[model samples]
Target: MTTVSVPSQSRLLNRELSSVEFYARVLELAEDDGLPLLERVKFAAIFAQFLDEFFMIRVAGLLELDEADLGVRSADGLTPAQALGAIRERIGQLLTRQAKLWKRGLRPALSDAGLDVATLEECSDKEREKLAKYFEREIFPILTPLAVGPGQPFPYVSGLSMSLGVIASDPASDEERFARVKVPEGLDRFVPVGKRLVPLEAVISHFLPMLFTGMEITERALFRVTRDADFEVSDDADDLLEAVESELRRRRFGDVVRLELSSSASQAMHARLVDGLGVKANQVYEVEGLLDQADLSQLVAHHRPELKHEQWAPVVPPRWARVKTAGGVFDEIRRGDLLVHQPYQSYRASFEAFAQAASRDPDVIAIKTTVYRTSDESALVSSLIECAEEGKQSVCLVELKARFDERRNIEWSRAMEQAGVHVVHGFPDLKIHAKMTLVVRREADGLRRYVHIGTGNYNASTARLYEDMGLFTADEEIAADVADLFNYVTGFGRPQQFRKLLVAPFTMRDRLVEEIRRVADAAAEGRHARIRLKLNALVDPTVIDELYAASAAGVPIEIQARSICMLRPGVKKLSETIRVTSIVGRFLEHSRVYWFESGDESCVFLGSADLMPRNLDRRIE
Candidate 1:
């Protein structure tokens, strides 16, 4: 056996901080000089969008815990307040780096490429006159100004919406009042004026005088609000769709979690805005550039495709391509389990086409699938609807609790129901995050089941961006397990046991723990022991502890986690035998693969479950 160094501490890393670190790594990609100019801008936009979600969900949750006096401690042992403080500090640093990258790197590169984000002062007379006429004719009609005074109430600020806060004084009487002008979300963030582009906020600020005709604009500043958009549905809720709709309606009025303002804002202006919103001083952020850097997506979307990374179309995997020659889709899968890696391989040509064929096949009688998140152009849904119209039985477990996707799922569920597909809105409390599809077909011998399991959503658009894998198998045991799993989800009937697959909220955690201990037992017996895992996150304390124990027993462990790793490796006497690496690249690493070896026995399993507690014990994945 080989010797492995052990870390001194027996503790997990902070999950919140680990998540922040992941975003920082993305920002590092944005800062990479080797990347194409526009590709770097895209990374910056992704980083900003990631941070927005972090605040809206993670940070807001922590604040809520602190306020509720729950004294919740993370798997890494940080109190809610401690975690919040650390998050704010790290976020401040990242915000500075993001601002610097835009100001010093992308902005200059863009200008050099003749795609400048110019200001009002930078525009020439002709451009300025054109913009003035454009603004008056197009933007002015939709503008609504709300005032704050003795009689007027403070206007409601919607979450993530950009706005201009103004302090205007009556020219003759010197009477000052505060008001707000919301930047329409529908308009482009950057308006083009001839060769240059202008920030929407800058245009609105320059024309603030026009909006407040007789008032002297004393102070004007760009600002944005981030609110707690996370909500829960009671397990006993009678109607899941209505519950989600109600929460969506209430999301806009959620407590303000973050307030971002321009760095140039006067102290008086900042203080007034802060007080009016009832946000604490710690929640305020003064940004040096655009209020919402996510809008940089517009800059990335510029038509300068030459400055961006070369686009590559996906190729159909040869195995899938050979299906026609082999007889049919069923014959191809029956030959052996077929695997296709996404982005590098086209999902539409393979997995989606499989469903389409299944729907049309005369032999196929029943189709059952789990729907988490899919796009409007989803051929899977279309196929399922078509199957129903053809008098074939079809069932779709559309998870309405898939965060940020509840509305679309609801709409799809209703549409599927109208088309005669039995649509089951998933459990009220347990979200079904699994990616699965089963098709039962009639054959000369008997009824045969074909199943497709994947590590990503059924969304065709994301399939082009996310690195994932899908398996087409006709194995009897796995097929039976999938059938039972679908039955459990749709009929509230749980299986007594699984033959090959490790399921979540039941046996996944325990089985994983058992496998780790098996490796440790093998190591203790003076045999080779090893484990490998790749996942989007690793935060379950129980699983981490088992890995720590396995490390102490001299088992070699390697993890390639894309985000939120709580286990701290490389420390003495704790986790030295373990190694962790995160990959941030053009395609998102979203698949989860696990491998374990001990003595003569070895096993490999792939599924949708992450090592996170929510995935293991709470969700129905």
Candidate 2:
């Protein structure tokens, strides 16, 4: 077993200071005048989304640790209990920044942009009458009001779902009452109030009297709950698919980790919710604006082109265009290997075109690919269905547990099956993270295999928005390895060694470790050595320690991680030679590129794997 050495306690920074200070710095940057106005709003939205996920996954995970009676200490020497306490304190401060942005920043800027988010008090009498009529016609029918009292139990609050809390008094008994009304998911999070936008919660609050009829309505507030959404599968399961299905079913019932309430919630109402949800007082958060700002993404799509960034269509490489124009897409592949950089270069011209060609070609024997994500109107999926309908073999290994994409993958798998395509739900315990496609063609000479290896998903929609790399090769060895990988995903045929491919859950992690060691050895021998890694995240402690060791040995390291990097850069002696920078722009930086320099021998590898424990050790290739 390869084990990474844990650094001494003295090396760890103060947990509260490290996490809280970084959050404060992010808030400072968000409020900085140097950034563009719209970009500042974007940053605020990004921070809110980030915090939402943190509550959903990280906070939930820590709560699970507490539930399991796990006493493991984090790298920073904080126990689960201590970590939760620290997170609550830090998150509270972060929420304060978010509230300030909404009140002091976004509201003013939005007003300047001629878009006003009106509160109930800000509405005219005619506008209020219009809202009341709209609420009665559309919203009243969808709401389910649940009373909490001696006869009624506390209602179950679904994860991230918003609700209106009503405080009413029974006209007969003069007893104080509490009732919860869940805002219908079908309704838009923000409804148009005349020319401006008003959050659905605010709209619902205005019509609370309609729901609780004959009761003296005293007060009303909005609240939401966020539960643990992470799915875990048992390793010893006899049937992987069954285990995954079961876990997916249970994900809805996970413990609540966060309860977001209106800042003006009464003390009685807060206490009742905290007890009802079985959540700690510290897990509760108070916000002045909308509970879930993720819905703001809808507002961002105003069709007002001038308010948004300029759209840039991905360019089609000359070679690809020539193939498409010449009516011979395969000729381009036959000539030589083609490399594509997505967003900058078109993915449909290459990957989607290959699938379409396979579907139309009579001599094509089989088409196989692993799908992690796809759009609703996926051209690649349509082509695969066409292949099946044309009496050609079409195999798809669909990962059903591709976070937040499970439902879509399930639907796609069913559609593929109905189309006579071989649909394989991947192993329950291990997610197949490889992005590959294989096509077998019967040619005049013999059989030929064309393969595509990408550093991102096959989803054309994401391809246009995510920075990724894809390689189209007719190389026999690479094609054979891809065949092996596909077979391994669809069946039980595991290849022990791969030619020109490093597969995770087998050799990828070991290969990375060995490469780092080689660089370290070269540095020790007075030879030039360096490593550059660009990834979306870096959380696996083994990789982090390896980079730390490399840094200690004087090997320069540059890392570009978009989110959740565990390694602390610029630490004296510990990581002095390591530099890290993250870039967030129009395109999501999704490609993972690893480059090493050992005495002028430069090597580069791109793949779909991140340096995370699940990707490295648990997920299948």
Candidate 3:
């Protein structure tokens, strides 16, 4: 519970700071002594990746606003500059904690468990000799060392790649010079010289003379770059695929947002990097131990079952096997709305089987779906290609601007287009984030459509790792609504009004706000009312204000967000009747559920839209 005077209160929390707190929770998992050894190790790796993304995208965004002097502020009363300062200080604390957790807790515990992560000095003479042979044969040939001098301006350093920034003296001239040797990304992050594992960077630093044969190495320090990778395509671009490919190329050389420098680095060395990379003082970080903890995933090679979480195999329901029949999926759905949960209920057995059956069924006349993110070797895309080959009407809206997944989505779009699938390569300003599929079959009585609306992507691999839900239904109104949505996406102009489905940038937000008001009114009239929400994020100011109003009216609100919630619950007079829980750990909670109840009336909704502003006002849901 939190209490604040009316003059000092800000009803909403900072989204970026809330995200940092979420990552801090992830770090807590890494520091947890109760979890399995490798499980904690996995969280450590996840924390690294999370921090990388925060710098690459979130921090980079704030720097853009700050540089432009736009002064973008949220309800949390923090401008972009203020948020960056808070983020930097808090993350510094987290990084300090992270380094200690790995060096003091995890590494030592793993060694005790017989899975040693040894340093160069810990290795025996025999192991050193073996490592020397392996490094020369497997790693040396792949290495490229670039010297920075008069003509060779600073070499272009890619984001997230670690490199050794070296200042060496030419013996003849006794003049110091700079050079960079990027640790080979192709090689494994950790190398196995003997029984123990060693960081590949350590081995590279150990044998620096092989590249600069005659130079005397004076100062050497490891550093990594986090570049501003976020990009937006102009709405006026003529060719989306070409534009997206160009953006991908530009993203490779984005501005350096964060610089991870070795704490042992000299002030002069730091200045060389600061000037060379064009990074400011605040953007540079000094960290001890590992620069990229994500590489700790290499511990999976230890093969100690007792040290890791037990492997899980998803169980498929027997009834889902009815997809063997040509119209089996439709038959199953026609009976009733079939709800599916992943990692608990097999995704391949249900969704993939539905697509496969739809591809092969001769009675099926059309298939439409949206692909925001999918597996590299996607069975769903394969089925769509086969359907198009069979001369059926097949349409796929592949979002090419899916952040880091742009290249993959671009490749998928080209493949689908080549296979005669009517492909829509996303819009310029908006991303179609809804996960749904529509299948129209030519039954004995005219035509009927079957639809699958989901809270997750059509990704088979992520299905085993993320907990998500979807409904396969043949409901007439819902199917028609989905059909109309596809027409709006694949066709020209605006979409026709939806009869049942709540489409974002249209009716979803309005409908949700209306329901919240209804619940508040019921509570104000002394009737029992309640609101429950389970989502990944909640940050839209309007919805949060509505929730606060409902809470003040005596309506109870409970929210379970898997990550990044801006609502501050249990504040007196403001949100005294509200509670929120962030569900993290194990599988990621991916499903979104909205339930509002007032006395005898009740309503429920599920979709990909979080209460975030982008989802409610900009993107399609």
For model 3, residues 300-356, the per-residue Cα lDDT tens digits are 556788887787777776778655686887888888898888888999888998898
Each model's lDDT comes to 0.89, 0.80, 0.89
Top-TM-score structure, candidate number: 1
In angstroms, the error of model 2 at 530 is: 1.7
**Candidate 2 lDDT (Cα, whole model)?**
0.80
Q: Write the per-residue lDDT of candidate 2 for residues 521-563, one digit (tens) a residue.
A: 7887889999999997787767878888888888999998776
The digit string of per-residue lDDT tens for model 1 on 43-69 reads: 998998998899899989988898998
TM-score of each: 0.97, 0.93, 0.97
- Model 2 residue runs over 4 Å out of place are 1-6, 10-43, 236-243, 325-327
For each candidate, how many residue pairs have backbone atoms clashing (under 3 Å)? 7, 0, 0
- Point out where model 3 deviates above 4 Å: 1-9, 301-303, 321-324
